[model samples]
Target: MTTSEQLHLPAGSTGRGNYETIIDPGAREGWVHTGLRVLALAPGGSEVVTANGVEAMVVPLNGACDVAVGGEDHHLRGREDVFASATDVLYVPVGSQLTISSKDGGRFALATAVATGSHPVALIRAEDVPVEIRGGGNMTRKVRNFGTVGAFDQMDSLIACEVITPGGNWSSYPAHKHDETVDDGDHQESELEEIYYYEIQDGPSGPGFGFHQTTSSGEDKPIDVLSEVRTGDTVLVPHGWHGPCAAAPGHDMYYLNVMAGPDPVRAWNITDHPDQTWVRGTWESAGIDPRLEGEAR
Candidate 1:
């Protein structure tokens, strides 16, 4: 992972609300790859937009909203309600206009990714699919097979899941990189890009943030980026030693990570930094983040 893979937005980059606009492909300045942007909506105005060359999925973190994708309208209320015990996934192809409006307006999170070709969009409900925890650490993750699930199959599409990392524990620790596709005795070979949209819990005012670092190929041109991120702030992980370090201050931090590679195959392939790869085998000795003891609202 190199510093060129990371993209950080200063304060007030996105609109208001709990939503922090991470990477707006339409508004991005430098670097060109498939882009991703996240919005944390508050209780007020509705978020309505037409998808141009992008495929999107609406996942609610705290509250619910009425989502309309590709002229089809569906009401997503809660996590358990939207994603049934059977299947909880939604697929929206490119060229579809997604209009999200909330009557009561609570905490609604939207993750949009740039599409390569034409792919039809569809809605996924949690109750429709089987829910299982493929992996766990400081955070417990639930995998809902949307694209691979036989029913909703599209060429070069999106993979969505819910990750709940416990407070104080490192969720994306031992930072890894997936910018390139390589077969080191894992499985087949494929290329895919990824994005990290973060949501952190703050004190009465706000919680202290975290830092992200990326190393270039050569040591002389190394890049060290340190930014204080809040609830709606997003960090772009194109490639590099990407880690979300939660400081001791307010509450726990939650981030919805959206990833898509060039290859049609949907899988997670990561390579850790040689210097820090040892940390992957030491989570058992560490305790949960003590700072997360604060009230969770």
Candidate 2:
């Protein structure tokens, strides 16, 4: 009963079938009826063959990497500081044998979920967890908590967050929806089930742009995806009205929003698409994404 497919890997583009390069998602193919899978690692080195079943998570979007998982080995570095929590979300367990290495290169964002019944835990990274900004002046958002916020209990299925919408401003602006129900009045519900995963900022001769929108449950039905994203592009929000409009006129737009669902309660309910719901009161006055001046890799 879940339908919405758009998986585009435009950066070298590897082998497999439906847009290949999958480091093993239980042999792919609609990935076990959408158990959730995302991989676009290709920089200097890569090796992740979870050949027993599935249960993986090694996220990093630019520079530094060295994970061995199961056999033990973790190290993810790269940050100008914007809520830094690069890499190390490994939880491979299903005959586990995950391996990854990058000697000063970049690009590595992998997220897999499929443990037959479920049982695989091991995460390491114990310090320097700072990157917070939740609603303040234009609803400014730049959170980065990286794993273990109750470890797999925001709906028990693994969750992740890394949002940064600084350019022309607007990060998920109003237009929201978590499938059917969860969170009401100012929205605050749970039923987890999401995935934004995007990256842009190549302008100034680099070429990178962005634009995303979805709506088709009435409410003026609209689905415009004005595309032009860089660094292993990906945009999927199984539900509806997902927003990402950081028009890179100068450069400053990053997205890394991964969510899980089944309703165990992790809180984050949204439902505002009645004509954009008045653009969330026009963000008070709108101001903050003025190219977000340096800092935050």
| Best model per lDDT | 1
lDDT of 2: 0.52
lDDT score for residue 233 of model 2: 59
Per-prediction TM-score: 0.72, 0.31
198-286 per-residue lDDT for model 1 (tens digits): 55555677564654454442344344555666656666655555664453334455555666656556666677666767865654454
For candidate 2, report its TM-score.
Answer: 0.31
User: Residue 240 in candidate 1 has what lDDT?
Assistant: 52
Worst 10 residues of 1 by lDDT: 288-297
Please tell me which predicted candidate would have the highest TM-score against the true structure.
Answer: 1
How much is the lDDT of residue 67 in candidate 2? 75
TM match of model 1 to true structure: 0.72
